[model samples]
Target: MAYSLDGVLVFGLLFVCTCAYFRKVPRLKAWLLSGSGVWGVFYKAAVIGTRLHAAVAISCIVMAFYVLFIK
Candidate 1:
């Protein structure tokens, strides 16, 4: 398997963004969770041959609902 420096950097940035955003803005917590859900499904599809775009999209949709209706 080939090691990807770009992939490592992307994920590293995502992790740092998650940590920093969670600490500064509480509202972004839900949005970050939604984005991470999308990332997880995407990464799983890339690494494990899983097709879960619908699930990831739904997660984002539900989060949108919470942002618009609940929050």
Candidate 2:
């Protein structure tokens, strides 16, 4: 796979998975990270994503590995 934006995206998702696993993101409090507006949208997504970390993480790894091995 090309080490471009796709790589960055995958790495970011994996990072999010790690953060979500440790409950470091999607904070319930109304602070800077979880504030309203654009961050709010992200926070909401993170809330759901963190709850489904297992499925998300597994699928991401599977897809990445599949792409890597296919070439």
Candidate 3:
């Protein structure tokens, strides 16, 4: 199955977020330290107007919180 660009982007973000979680780093830190948060980065990419990134980001964020507080 071929993945669309949006799908690839979302998965890549999720993988990085997961790795960061395991390493105990802040979620989306690379993006935030680069001068934009995940939302801002994805917003700029949203010229295509797909919600995939935002949805995945929110999921990753929630997972990060869960790992930090519960796990």
lDDT, each prediction: 0.46, 0.62, 0.49
For model 2, the local distance difference test gives 0.62
Considering lDDT, which of the candidate structures 1 and 3 is the better prediction for this target? Answer: 3
Candidate 1: residue pairs that collide:
none
Q: Give the total clashing residue pairs for model 1.
A: 0
Q: After superposing candidate 1, which stretches have Cα over 4 Å from the reference?
A: 1-50
Q: Is candidate 1 or candidate 2 better by lDDT?
A: 2
Q: For candidate 1, write residues 38-71 as lDDT tens digits.
A: 5554333332222443554465466557547865
lDDT of 2 at 38: 72
Q: Residue 65's C-alpha lDDT in candidate 1? A: 71
Model 3: what TM-score? 0.32
RMSD of each: 16.1, 4.2, 11.0
Give per-residue CA lDDT, model 3, range 1-71, as digits (tens).
12665455546565554443433335544444343565554434432223354665776676567557864
Descending-TM-score candidate ranking: 2, 3, 1
User: Judged by lDDT relative to the true structure, which candidate is superior, 2 or 3?
Assistant: 2
Pick the lDDT winner.
2
**Order by lDDT, highest first:** 2, 3, 1
